[model samples]
Target: MKKIIKTVICIAALISAVSCMNNTKTLLPNVSGKAGEVIIVVGKDNWEGNLGNEIGGLLARDCEYLPQREPLYSLVNLSPGAFSDMFKLHRNIVIFNIDSTVVKQGVVYRTDVWAHPQCVIQVNASCADSAIVVLEKNGENITGAIEQAERNRVIANTLLYEESKLGDVVAKMIGGRVHFPVGYNLKKVTDDFIWIADEKQYSTQGVFIYKYPATDEDPFSEENIIARRNVFLKEYVPATAENSYMTTSVFVKPGIKFLKYHNLDFVETRGLWEVYNDYMGGPFVSHSFYSKDGKDIIVLEAWVYAPKYDKRQYLRQTESLLYSFEWDEDGNDGK
Candidate 1:
C-alpha cells in the first residue's frame, strides 16, 4: 500500500512539471494590434496605408516604412545587435521620422527618426549620425485595438491638407485637357519626400504600368513605357527655354536625370523619357519645378485606365512614398 501511494505522488509531480513547461509562453514576433499603439517587436512602421486613420490600426500591427528613400538616422535607432537580429527575419516594413532644424548658412538638415533596418545615403550628412529607437508594449498586444475613428488625427489631417494642396494645384492646371487624379491622397510625406497620387485612369488601355514593383521593371520595354505613349498629349510648357529641348532633361533641384520627369510638348520638348528600372509604380505625382516663370511652369501628367479597375478604387494602396523636389541646378534646370 505504501509503495503504490508513493508511485502515485511521483506521477502527479511529473505531470505538473510537464504542464508548466508547455504553458511557459513562447517568445516570438506577432503582427496584429489596435490603432495608434505601435508594436515594438519590429522597428518599422508596418501600417497598411501610406496616410490617414486606418493607418493607425495597421501601424499597431507592424512597422511600415517609406521605402522610396534610404533610411539614415532611423536605422541607428535600434541597437546594432537588435537590428541585426531583426533583419534576419526579412523585415520589409520601415518607420522614418524626418525631423529638421535650421542651421547656419541657410541649410535644413533632418536629424532624427525611430525605426529598424535603416541607412542614410542621400542626405547631405554623415552616415555615423547618432539615433535611438523606443519600444512599448501595452496590454496583450491587441488588447485595445480601435478602428480608425479619429479621421482628423495628425496623420489624416496633415495628409488631407498637403495632398489637397498638390492634387488641387495639378487638377486645376490640367482641368479638362488631361485626366487628373480621380482620387488622391498623400501615401507618404516627410521633409525629404512627398507622395500625392491615387488610383486614376489615363488612356483607355488596360492597367497602367505604374501598378508594378518599379524596382524590377524594364523602363525600355514596350510593356512598360507604353503608358506614357498611349496618353499622347501635345501642350506648350513655357520652361526656362534653355535646356527645354534636350533629350535628357532633369529639372528638379540638384537634378536626377533619366529618372523622374514627363515629356510635355507645348512650346519645347526634349529627352527620351524612360522610367528607371528602380522606379516603382502607383500613387503618382507630377515632378517639381526648379524655378518658375510665374505659376505656369506647367507640367502635364498622363494616366490611363486599366481594364478591370473599379473606377478610382486603388486610391488607397500606395507602398512607400515622399514628396519634395530638389533636382534643379542654378535655376538652369541642368539637363
Candidate 2:
C-alpha cells in the first residue's frame, strides 16, 4: 500500500511539472489588464440576483488602511457568451456557470488560460443555492489567490525598473538590502535613518528604513512600534508647516501582527498616518525585524500620499519593496 501511494505521488508530481511547462510555452500573451482588476463572467440573469451578491461580496470587499473605501478588486461583469479572446487575457478572472446540467458543484483554477501570468477561476453548480454554498466555503481562498497573483506581477514589474543605488546604500549601512525602482531617490539619510521617495506631480510614494539596538523583546510590541515610529518620522519626515511632522494617527490606532517572510521573522503594522499640525495624511505600512547579527532591530516602512486618487494600487506597489529585503549571508558585503 505504501508503494502504491508513493507511485501515485510521483505521477502527480510529473503531471504538475508538465502542466507548468505547457503553461510557460503557451502562445497566449501576458495579461493586459491593470492591477487590482478582475473580470467576472456570468449569465445576465444570475449576474443581478443572489449569485451576483455572493460573488461581489467576496471579491469586491473593501481594502484596509485606505482613507477612502475602495473595493479590493475592480470587478468587470462580463457575460459568459461574450467571453471572447480579449476578455480571457485578463490578469484575474472568474467564470460562474450556474445550470441544472452542471450536476454537482466544483471549482477549477487554471493558470495562463489565455495569457501568461494569469489566474482563471471557474465555478460550476447545478443550481444557484448550491453555488452560493460552495462560494461561501471557498471564497477566501479564491480571493487570496487572485491577490497573490497581482502581487507577484508587481514584483516582476519592479525588476524591470533600473536598480537604484539606494538599495545598495541600505545594504551597507543597515545590514540588509531592499530593491528600489529607478525613479526613487535618496530623500534623506542620517545616523540610523534612511528615507527614499518618488515624488510626482500629484502623488508621492516613500519608504523609510531605520535600525535600533534590540534592547529587549518588548521593542516588537505594537505600542512600542507606534511609539518608536512616531519618533523616527517626527525627526525625519517633516511637513511644509512649521513644527509639523508625520506621525501615526491614534484615532484609527494602527494594527500589528507577527509574521515570517523571506526567512525573517517580523512584526507588521498597518494604519493611517497624519501630519502633526497639517491636514496632509494617507496610509502607511511597516515591517519590523531583527538584523542577522541579532543585535539590532530593523524597520522597513512604505507610505503613500495620493490625495486625489484611490490608494490601493499605490500601496501595493510600494509594499512589494518590503518583500524584496535580503540579508547578506557571506558577510563580505551588504548588497
Candidate 3:
C-alpha cells in the first residue's frame, strides 16, 4: 500500500508540473511594423493639440550625424478609436490616456503586450497639460525604451543568421567577441586593427575594431578618439582615387556622449566621414571603452555609405552590431 501511494504522489507531481508549464507558456504573434517605425495612439483632440506636437517633436526629431534630415523614428499617429487589433501588433507603440477619471498619472512601460518583441508605453494623466508634463519628465526614458526595442530586434535577427566565423576572428583580434550577421566579410585584419564590411553595389556598411594602450590622460576624449580614427582610416581604409583615404570630416564637428549599456561604460562619438581626396562621405559612430583588464582602450566603430538611399536605417543596422559586443569572459563569446 505504501509503494502504491508513492507512485500516485509521483504521478500527481508530474501532472502538476505539466500544468504549471502550460500556464506559464505564452504563444504571442510576431510584431508588426518596419524597422524604425512607431505607432502613436491618442484622442483626436490630443492628436491635434499641443500635446501631440510635443510628442511628435520629441520622437520624430532629426537623427544625429546624418548628412540629410531624417526623423529619428517614422511615427504613425492614430486616434484611440482607430487603434484596432491590426495596429496593436506593431513593434513600438505609445498610448496616451488623458481623462479626468484617470487614477494613474505617470508613464508605464510594458513589453510583449499584444505581440512578441513589442514595446508598449502607456501614459495616464488627468488632462492634456498633465500629459505633456509627464512626457516632458520622461521624454528621454521614452525615447530610450523605443530605441532599445529597435536595437533588440536587430540583434535578434543578427543572432538568428549570425556569421559564426567572424565571432572567432574578432575574439582573436580584440580578446572579445562581436556578433556579425551574414553578408559581412573580413575586409582587413591586422595586429591592432580589424575591418569587417557588407559591401554592395550602391551601399557599404562596415565596422572597425581596434585597440590602443590606455594612458593616464583622458583617452576617451573627442580629440584623441578622432585623431586615432583618422590615423587608422588613413592607413587601412582607402578610397578608389589615388592618394584618397577616409577621415573624419571637419565640416561638422563630432559629438561625444558617455553611455552605459549592460554594465559596460563607454564613450560614444558620432560624426561624418569623408574620403580625403574624393567627394564621398556619410555618417559614422563609434564606441570607445576600456578593455577587460583596463590596460587598453578598445574601439568599435560602424559607418554607413549609401549615397543613393536614405542612411538612417543603414546606419542604425550597422550601429546595432556594435552593441552586440561581448568580452570572452562574459560567456557570450558563442553569440
Q: Pick the candidate with the highest lDDT.
A: 3
Q: Candidate 3 overall Cα lDDT vs. reference?
A: 0.93
Backbone clash pairs in model 2 (N, Cα, C under 3 Å; residues 3+ apart or in different chains), count: 0
For model 2, what is the error of residue 197's alpha carbon versus the real structure, in angstroms, after optimal superposition? 0.9
Local error of candidate 3 at 39, Å? 0.6
Clashing pairs in 3: none
Error of 1 at 261 (Å): 17
For residue 132, model 1's alpha carbon misses the true position, in angstroms, by 22
> How many clashes in each candidate?
39, 0, 0
List TM-score per model, in order. 0.21, 0.87, 0.95
lDDT of 2 by residue, 47-135 (tens): 89998998889988888888999998999999978999888888999988888988768888888888989998999898878889989
Stretches > 4 Å off in candidate 3: 1-6, 330-335
lDDT tens digits, residue span 1-335, model 1: 99999999999999999999899855444222221222122223322223212223333333212112211111122322364543433222233232334121111211111222211111111111211211122212222121111111322334534443543332332221121222454443332222234544552311111111233244333333333322321111112344231111132212112333233222111122322232212212222221143322233222222334321222212211111112232333222
Among all windows of 10 consecutive residues in model 3, the one with the lowest summed lDDT is: 326-335
Which wins on TM-score, candidate 1 or candidate 3?
3
